[model samples]
Target chain A: MGEVKNKQVILKDYITELFKESDMDIVEGAITLELPEGPNEVLLKNLYLSCDPYMRNRMNKILKIEGPATLLVGYVWGFTKWEEYSFVPSSRILFKIEHTDVPLSYYTGILGMPGITAYSGFFEVGLPKKGDKVYVSAASGAVGQLVGQFAKLSGCYVVGSAGSKDKFRFSVFVNTSKSFANNLILHASPPLHLNAYLSTTILQIRYFPEGIDIYFENVGGKTLNAVLLNMRINGRIVVCGMISQYQSAQPEGVTNLKKLITKRIRMQGFVVRDYYPMYPKYLEYVLTKIKEGDIVYVEDIVEGLENGPAALVGLFNGRNVGKQVLLVSRE
Target chain B: MGEVKNKQVILKDYITELFKESDMDIVEGAITLELPEGPNEVLLKNLYLSCDPYMRNRMNKILKIEGPATLLVGYVWGFTKWEEYSFVPSSRILFKIEHTDVPLSYYTGILGMPGITAYSGFFEVGLPKKGDKVYVSAASGAVGQLVGQFAKLSGCYVVGSAGSKDKFRFSVFVNTSKSFANNLILHASPPLHLNAYLSTTILQIRYFPEGIDIYFENVGGKTLNAVLLNMRINGRIVVCGMISQYQSAQPEGVTNLKKLITKRIRMQGFVVRDYYPMYPKYLEYVLTKIKEGDIVYVEDIVEGLENGPAALVGLFNGRNVGKQVLLVSRE
Candidate 1:
């Protein structure tokens, strides 16, 4: 195959603060569409790209995505680059998309890493019981959305916050750079500063004066502190990500940790990598839930590979409404 | 029945800061040495009074103890008044001293609350594995002492601190008040302020450069923050008490909680009441260990009930070492 014009999004530098569109550079690159000779290699015409919080946190320093003509791609090396065409090692790919009935873009969200993350973090780690008062931060996002739905499915009462999920109160929209943006979902006045997020969250948690039983933590720092104060006896906190603290030199101090002892609470952190073994079981259950209308997933997809940079940075602010995905190609 | 003059340690008022000897007043009050009419009432002479960190913390506000008199007592009413002789509802007493071969005072610690606390907190909540690196704060105290021995019993590497144990580095003798005192066990310069406790702990953790797999958390606030920094991936922290913050009007903030997510740590808080069901099993195991000399306990015993006030206040400033037991009368 001849070299095809492949547009790319390259991370210009390591982000120190809130992610900016200028931090990334869009460039046109070319790649041969032929699969290079390798034992477990396949040429993946990048269809949808995922933008997740852990992509930056787990990587330690920066989020890197190779533009077109990516010679190497593996799950261990992170998702395929934000480009049109790429060579992917089959061994590194976490799973194959067997069910085509759902939107192919779903692979980047409810059917992918974010999906399993919510599955294991909530059910396995959180250990929700029926009638449990569950709280989810970053609720409009990929994993948070599923956690809320899962809580409800487990016969628990769930309250979701972050972005414009009308059912949830307080827009605690946390971005990667730790810079919060315009309020979109808060019932009362939204907190402008990052530090004030905890006080406001504590105030808003008054809605559940009785207390939260299971807290699906996505945005850490202040929100986590607030959750600590509102946690009921024997409550469980499933720490999945600290998106609010990703860009921070020093993450905020959580003061109410003594409550863990006072209330007999359990806070646990888990990585999806450990839970991948149960993926097949999770898939059957989740797919069935999706078909039965028991669960819902919202995707905020930006079309065209060139818009990938904008969509990714949008995650830092409340600009993106749901699971942030960039469409690289229709294939 | 003739009324007998009974000595009692009375809590004068709610403590504001560090527990002062003046906070408790020793008094001689009269009590009828007769069994009460209640079905489970027992006319008993108080032998030993236990001074525990939780006695001040779990009660929410001030640590209150009634002076000896012809009055009522229940398990929910906290420990029997720090007294010489009293009428105790049999229901209020946690257990009967079954094995007399051991010190009868063992009921106040190793064979009682502190014993089961270390057992359940270490084995049940911590979920420690063999060869795990375990760190215990307030290591010379009742619960921490046992937690360290339990870690060793579990075939894990144990490092303990607080109150000149020679074996463990750094004297982190946390009292009810946040005030730190003259360094006791510290090989290096002891941190002066309460805030520096975290940074110093983080520094000392370099001894176990590899990382801590289990942190038996006895002191909360700063030390807890320090443990988070040195925690290995998949570490477990058993939150037993927050002795450091027991007297503070506002507890110190614990930063580094995000490490829970990065390292996939599990921190759980448990009450001894929950583990009482397994007391028989724990008693057998601990008694056998004690007889085998596999475990050692230190007790800073005050000879008379009059000295109880001094011994109790001594706990806040590293004055009392080991279990901090007050000997009212010996059988």
Candidate 2:
């Protein structure tokens, strides 16, 4: 391995306001493609990089940053840019690609961290039983789509809410512009009118008439508040992400938390890193689902490292149609 | 058994605004002190009545009312007034008075619903470990006091916040007036300056240097938001009650819910009815603690049924120094 010209997306400055593409600087840098002499060091050509919502949280200075530059390829190493040909610690790579028949890019989205997130969040946290009424927010995205499919596989009546109608098979397509108005109505009204607005709650009740047993929380904010209203007794709210509130100057205040007590709801948040040990089992299950055509994944691939900054920022704006991925190289 | 003059306190109307003493009507009524001809009917002289925060939720017609008039006393029977003698179902009496060595009023506080709430919320939901940092809000209240004691017994470092200086041995005495100002400062600042205000977060950090492992959430609103800022990784927030917001026309919005995802926090709410099966064990455990003098319970007893309405209303006003109970008649 030799030093190579690496086209990189550098975080020139921490984003103080809502994320803009200009916040990232695309710079031409050189990297020695050889692993440093250490017991736990791995060298690999970056094939596919994932654009996740949680990556936005890292842009803020409050959260702790840990691990090598290329470790998770996205979350860790605050200064690590969208670069080509980087070296990372061997331990970071939880598993090596064994099944080459599938697209290697699948490792970044459907078969990687997001896959484990969907698996653990849905099965362990959500605790969906047969005939359980399940509701998932941001249902077209990386994790939500899998969560909905997983619920369907468990004989649950799964309803998904997405930003647009064309993204995926969403039960409710929430128009982002109208959603703010819906949120205002849901928050202002004390008696939670089911017919007042086409809010997440009304749509949820319309789809799952019996009320939501398990809520796979991805978008958070108004969706979370709406779900809180429609949750059944002893309902489970698996808090995966709050993507909607990440960019706001002041995060929205959740007023309907009292419903948690009345409904005996368990709202829990978990990270994929904690559930990494079960990756092998999850991989097998997800691979089988893909092979059987029971699961389908959509990826919005943006070519070249220079376009990575735009693709990453596009996530906050809900610009991408599916799991936004930056194709660094074909490998 | 004959008909007797019963001085009753009837809810004049459903209170949509903050609860006031005027909302209740003291009426002269009569009740036959005889058991009805039914297998599951029990006619007993109402001895001690409990004034709990949950009763406020019932005042709003949104929450479901289950069982006959006297079960949990105030929460059920929308029309059940603050009365002297009442007819109730036999099954409603969850426990028979096994030990008379303690005050019968203990059945309303330490030996009753609040006792179970503390035990289960702390042990089952909070899941505190040895050396864990525990913080309880409304620390001198029925449930909060016990939760602190229980945390201490489990070899955990416990800190409690109370509204007044005289209420029990609170680790931090949060002056209610100053607390409101502190809450304003805390909410206004996004960066969270440690020295800006002696807010719940600062007081919490002063008590638990390592951050909070378990937060026994008896008082929500501002305290909850402050606790959210200082929660340790994988922290447990047992959602017992939000007494601060129960009376308000609009509940406060919790702005720091993003902390849930960052810290992988678990916030769960449970009612005592769900954990009734654990009553025997909790009873034995609490009784032993009382006998050993490891736990000390204080009750603010208002004598006579006429004072019941005033005492119940006093709970909202923070007039009661301890567990507010009404003495209906001597055993």
Candidate 3:
């Protein structure tokens, strides 16, 4: 009876396209049923597929694109074309999912890259002190949401920016309600709904009249310039991603950067993969916050694998309200 | 004999001008027959004068500049104008120089604004860590000389840039010969001599091949751009003066400031007067170094008060080799 039930299931796995437009190809392959023979390589079913702005770089052929996945390209010397699959040989890339009582989709959003990114970026790079005013760009997105919550926990005056009015309202509401780690997001400050472009500039001037001490910069270009002007002396800018200029043929020129000298600002760019050492501790803290209802986890889940194209493309346009994730399978 | 000596002295009192082009009016005043009864207001006969780049700001009748006496430009709000005979307003500008063991000329250079600027900027702001790379612009000048020495004492790799080839060689000689507490300027690289236009930029690049950990920036403009590009992660740039842009109609726009983001650079402009609390300690430490021959002091002593004008103006043109000090009442 068990063999019959297993055979009838016919497990369907999520497969991402190698190239876009006319060259797009999706692999129809069976899910690997092989279990871990040893301590290494825990077979993850990838129940919730993380759809990030950075992943857009991985979708195209490496030579033609640049971003987080370029990390893999540096090691992989030559690839003829993006045909069948992209495999990265690593001693460890997959980790066993322990203590999985909460929603599995949490792994794709808060519990994964986004969570650890906020953790390292806020503490290690941003260096947020108690009572510091922090401004996070793309506040409703995966990394941005967690960073805003973390700032609140760090005893900072946290103000966030999102593209749509709905997402901005939702983020403020979620944070104020203590959806993420019982940390208080100020209920006051009359609903900060701003256009993504004007929001980047106005939030800097309005929210940070004295100037922003820390900026978790996900969207770059004019946002960076505005932040540069609105930065306090010794302000810290953590360059998580430049999503705004990612699709452009040429990187946008930032003119007002000389303000860094007058303001004594410190800015740095980093990738979460570089800081894997803190992942275990980060996972423990984040998951605890989730289970205790101290940290609220939100995911804009696309129900099926077929909608991956629209969801992935929508990242640039700030379409997702929360972490844009695809529910591929149920473990 | 006392009366004859007093008459022979020709008590030449000076009054500083409120505007730049105004002559420093010298008044023929009678000498005091007896010492005035006062506690800490020992009358100092105008002896030697220090001409500095900072003093140019004081020459202009602009907004109230908040810095050393040399940099302060207002309506002679606190200071006795050029060639003006006046008593020190004890409460107004504190620490009126009393009986000094050293030459009163030292007050204008080593013991005055530039001296404290060097002491405060190098130790307090630069925060020279052991084995850190240090770069100083305007090496032969007052602040640059002391900063280089301080870096050496901190067990840092120090390199300095001067305008003249002679000054460059002299700094190298001083770096090697000095035995101050921190006199350990590592001769890992060649000394840099910069041209007027590309001076700051090329000097920054050459001095900090691995990128400067601390930059004592005296000349701003293209140099700032170079320093921005060549700064290591967490590098500190102390903007003491913007000599390059001081006379320009508009400040030269520095373009390469985007490097600050990637490098996590910190650039700060400071006035040495903010560090009055450490004056006594700085005086003691520097005097000790001078007395022990551990730190070598150099001055461009232009003889005759008539030559003072050329000496003072030479600073902006990079014509003055060392501290531009004029001999009035010579030893």
Global lDDT of each candidate: 0.71, 0.71, 0.59
Query: Largest DockQ belongs to which candidate?
Result: 2
lDDT tens digits by residue: candidate 2, A235-287: 99999998878887787788889888878899999988899889889988989
What TM-score does each of the candidates earn?
Answer: 0.86, 0.86, 0.66
lDDT of 1 by residue, B7-82 (tens): 7777767666667788778788899877688687666677777778766653335344433211222211125667
Q: Taking the tens digit of each residue's C-alpha lDDT, what string does model 2 give over B244-274?
A: 7887777778888988887899999998888
Residue B2 shift from truth in candidate 1, angstroms: 1.6
Sorted on lDDT, best first, the list reads: 1, 2, 3
Across A126-152, the per-residue lDDT of candidate 1 in tens digits comes to 988899988888888889888877777
How much does candidate 2 score in TM-score? Answer: 0.86
Error of 3 at B34 (Å): 13
Clash pairs, candidate 1, are A175-A316
TM-score of 1: 0.86
- Could you report the DockQ of all the candidates, in the order they appear? 0.64, 0.69, 0.14
RMSD of each: 6.4, 7.2, 9.3
Candidate numbers sorted by TM-score from highest down: 1, 2, 3
Across A190-222, the per-residue lDDT of candidate 3 in tens digits comes to: 354343334354655446778889988887776
